[model samples]
Target: MSRRPPARRRPARRPRRPRQQQEHLVGLLLAAAAALWLMATVVHWLLAHWWILLAAAVIAVLGGIGWWQQRVQRAQWEHAQARALRYGLPQLDALSHRQFEYTVRDLMYRDGCTDAVQVGGQGDLGADVKATDPHGRRWVIQCKHRRHGEQGAAVGTPELQVLNGTGRPVHKADVVVMVTNGRITQPGRDFARQQRLHLVDRQLLASWAAGSRPLWELLPALPPPRKPSRLS
Candidate 1:
């Protein structure tokens, strides 16, 4: 453009440090020397006290073997206890109200709901037991214990109403159930069926407690098994 103003000269770049200085040669040499000395000292010590390492290795092996044997023995004892345990309607009816909730939790655990827990107490919001089945379906169970068994006051619609309202929105249950070692009134059963709620009546409870089938398998219209990632 207008003779392009006499070509401007670019300023010279600052010179780089000398190769030895830039590489930090002295520091690198010192570090290498220190590392070599440390390695030599460790090797000499290990050689002089080799029996200590051998003793430690032997102790570790013995400890591991002992731990493994104890674990196996414990597992066998648990299996024997499970085989001896039994459940029936009479057994369930004899339990106190709180014990009934714990029994339900234990049944869930026996059926492979390893995370089953008894949450019944004050402020339970109608959920007595909560568990996640092996299929990843969440369960909220309400236990109604009748000391008189089937002859006691029947489980009525009021309890079902509370469970229907809170079981899903509050407990995030995929399958909501009412478990009683007693009868549910006709109206309660009708409401439960209409609302897609599951019921474990005295008869069904007997079968579930006595048989090997999982509770989910015994109930109808359960939600499809969910992905483990989808479980809360």
Candidate 2:
């Protein structure tokens, strides 16, 4: 009876689909042949119509160039718009004296003047802003803000004389600049010319803010054989 125990039955194995495998291979071969035939036909057509292909290539190149130009023009327009909105020069007249000095400091910073700082106060020694340009030249800047209808004469020669005295001796500055939202008198300009001082007047400031010109480009020319100061 013990030897007569029932035998365990194994699970049936699934049959492989040989026909389906052959069909898949045949389908792949047919697809590859079709692709080759299509490529051959296209190549033959292109060879027969070489002039058309050349024309198409030329058209493609022209279209690419036009697209690139449009992109460049769009970028330029966007830049101009951003520059127009970044700063409003006339609005500086409404700021307080300290605010004006801070604005001058910001402008210097934008113009590659490192460590640009506003030091304007009661006893600031005539330097409203102090910074070092990219060329490592120390600059002492004085900011003069004037309203539309103030009763005082514009910044005159006397102001330059005072600034000169403070820039070199007191501040040990290599460059002296006077920035004004108003006008610089002709006498003041003459004095500045003699002292090698930089004067940024209203129009120049506006141009710089409007992104039409850089501050270094607006600097006065030096004596013969002297190189222009470059921004860092």
Which candidate has the highest lDDT of all?
1
Global lDDT of each candidate = 0.91, 0.80
TM-score quality measure for candidate 2: 0.57
Model 2, residue 156: distance off in Å is 0.4
Candidate 2 worst ten-residue window by lDDT: 223-232
TM-scores for every candidate against the unseen true structure: 0.73, 0.57
How far does residue 219 in candidate 2 sit from its true spot (Å)?
A: 0.6
* Residue 63, model 2, lDDT: 100
Best by TM-score: 1
- Put down candidate 2 lDDT per residue, 17-101, tens digits, no spaces: 9878999999999999999999999999999999999999999999999999999999777555544443566587777888889
> lDDT by residue for model 1 over 74-163, one digit each (tens)?
977865665444589899999999999998988888777878999999999999999999888899999999999999999999999999
Name the runs in model 2 displaced over 4 angstroms: 1-85, 149-152, 222-232
Model 2: per-residue Cα lDDT at residue 158: 85
Task: Flag regions of model 1 displaced more than 4 Å.
Answer: 1-47, 228-232
lDDT of 2 at 83: 42
